[model samples]
Target: MDTILGVSKLSSKFQVTIPKDVREILKVSPGDRIVFIHEEGKIIIKKA
Candidate 1:
């Protein structure tokens, strides 16, 4: 089953830091590209 890793708030500049657990799960690192998808009133992020 899926589980919630953590939560983050948007900064003044409209940026957010990915939680460590999520990043580890996604296997992303610095300089990697991430894609954002908008569907059904929800936003999804995926590694590109």
Candidate 2:
């Protein structure tokens, strides 16, 4: 369950691709909703 993916590139639209390990860790799939919140200077990412 451990893997790493490097950033390929960023498109002109400001969209960045999520690494495979991160995606799996977050249990994110296509069309899945994710929420980002800021707490105590840290970013919290959660699945919605």
Candidate 3:
């Protein structure tokens, strides 16, 4: 696994807001598409 850059609390709706540091690392903004990958027991998120 990579280094932990940020953290967020999951909401009751099963949703979590991405942290600002992570957003910066992903270079993403509002309306940007995000890709979710399931691998090795981890959920990987990336900008699409």
Candidate 4:
């Protein structure tokens, strides 16, 4: 598996942009949906 690294910054509207490397590793393209899960105080992003 490939590891992508990038810092996350929150916009004024509270929206975040996923790092390009991470998106590519996950093979995510435009219009694809993702799921955000919270467990034990950790957030996980997964393809939907």
What lDDT does each candidate get? 0.91, 0.78, 0.90, 0.86
Q: Name the lDDT value of residue 6 in candidate 3.
A: 77
Off by over 4 Å in 2: 1-10
Superposed Cα deviation of residue 24, candidate 3 (Å): 0.5
lDDT of 2 by residue, 7-48 (tens): 547889977777787788899999999898999997666888
**Candidate with maximal TM-score:** 1
Query: What alpha-carbon RMSD in Å does predicted model 2 have with respect to the real structure?
Result: 4.2
lDDT of 4 by residue, 1-43 (tens): 8454888899999988889988987789889999999988978
- lDDT for model 3 comes to 0.90
Residues 1-48 of candidate 1 have per-residue lDDT tens digits of: 846789999999999999999899889999999999998897888999
Q: Which stretches of model 4 miss by more than 4 angstroms?
A: 1-4
Candidate 3: where is the Cα deviation over 4 Å? Answer: none
- TM-score to native of every candidate shown: 0.81, 0.65, 0.81, 0.77
Instruction: Write down the TM-score for model 1.
Output: 0.81
Candidate 3, 1-48: lDDT as tens digits: 678877888899998899889999999999999999999999989898
Of candidates 4 and 1, the better by lDDT = 1
Provide the lDDT at 22 for model 2: 75
Clashes of 1: 0
